[model samples]
Target: MNTMKKLAAISLVTAALAAPADLTASARPARATGLPAAAKGCVPAMIDNFMTGAYRSPDLTTGSVTNTESGAMLGGRRTTRFQVAGNPFGFPSTAVVAPGDKSLLAVSSGYKGPTALAVFYGLRSEAHPEVLRADLSCFKRFEVNFVANDLPLNINVEVKSASSPTVYQCGVNTEAGQTNGFRLEFPFDCFVTNDPAHPPVDWTRIDRVLLLIQSASAMAANDYAINFFRLAS
Candidate 1:
């Protein structure tokens, strides 16, 4: 799991879902002070260091976030491949740029455990499992930096491993109208494992990262927005 940081820090969360229900959205790899010490041969695999904005973008778009990049990654714009339950999935999930000119990524998800996900297809080759894990080894933790408003009053972030089909999820306690930058950390241990044959997380081929929001407390407020994001440490 990743270390959730607000203001690039955390204030001892109350566990479980908390506070009021407000998706009036707004929007952590490490406490990366500045860049990195040097470009490691691969994505920094430093367990002690949170690598942010230091990895190769490969084909990174100009935008700060990748909510819109999922379509291209999965070779489709709207998809039902990520849903675990709640059949009769709704129409296309949306990724909208909020006010302040590309300020936030506003993602509108459907009811019934709405999930928004994007895959970085082939970012790491399955041909080299050893190489893949070695490259991403430093990243034992995962967290996102964002401002929470109206979206997933009770939030869970899921990551699908390449080795298994189970979607591992960790609950995040989101604070409303929080432009102060809240982060939910999901470490490897936090992911639930139903497959005994393969590990819950296949670091070598991490596949896709999905944002599964709890059914919106208020349907109208299910959609949410965030300032930006960071994947590091």
Candidate 2:
């Protein structure tokens, strides 16, 4: 998304917030720019242009998985999962980690129909243990990207967790129907310690990852993609 366009959108949102009743009349459909006209529903377009620019040094390790093929599996069957480990690109100068800080970058191409994608990472302490909880560290973060045609995109993020089942859902953006795309970055401090209450991350043990993609409604056609990076010392 263009900076000027973002500014204009923010301005409109601010104006709407200032006067709730005048929202309907004050809010005018923004003239579409480079967006496709024939594009009826939401189409997932990769916002690669914004990422190509210069970023601070210490390049972070990054990876991604898409839901175009197998789709997300919930209960019965398994799903295709991908993983890239240990700062694939080597740590960049800018990729710095403080005592309690964790940073990440996540993005996705726009989706035309309806689709969802989630990416998560965890830090484990020590090797095997009698109690499962003893070996697990902290669930660094969880991120979700949702999109649908002719509707706005929804982006959500949460910090800290022990163990949680991954699930995906689809719905209409009834409130902000004009949203077409979104991007987010998160930073935090604190790690799962080795104590009984807060166990240390078992770096020696293998970490698990899960990705889910589901089409809840009929005539649903869309693409789901995500790229994530972790910053460490």
The numbered model that scores best in TM-score is 1
What C-alpha RMSD separates each model from the true structure? Answer: 13.8, 23.1
lDDT score at residue 191, model 1, on the 0-100 scale: 64
lDDT of 1 by residue, 112-131 (tens): 33432221222221111111
Give candidate 2's whole-model lDDT: 0.24
List the candidate 2 regions with Cα displacement exceeding 4 Å.
1-139, 144-180, 183-206, 229-233
lDDT of every predicted structure (CA atoms): 0.36, 0.24
Q: How good is model 1 by TM-score?
A: 0.46
Error of 1 at 168 (Å): 3.0
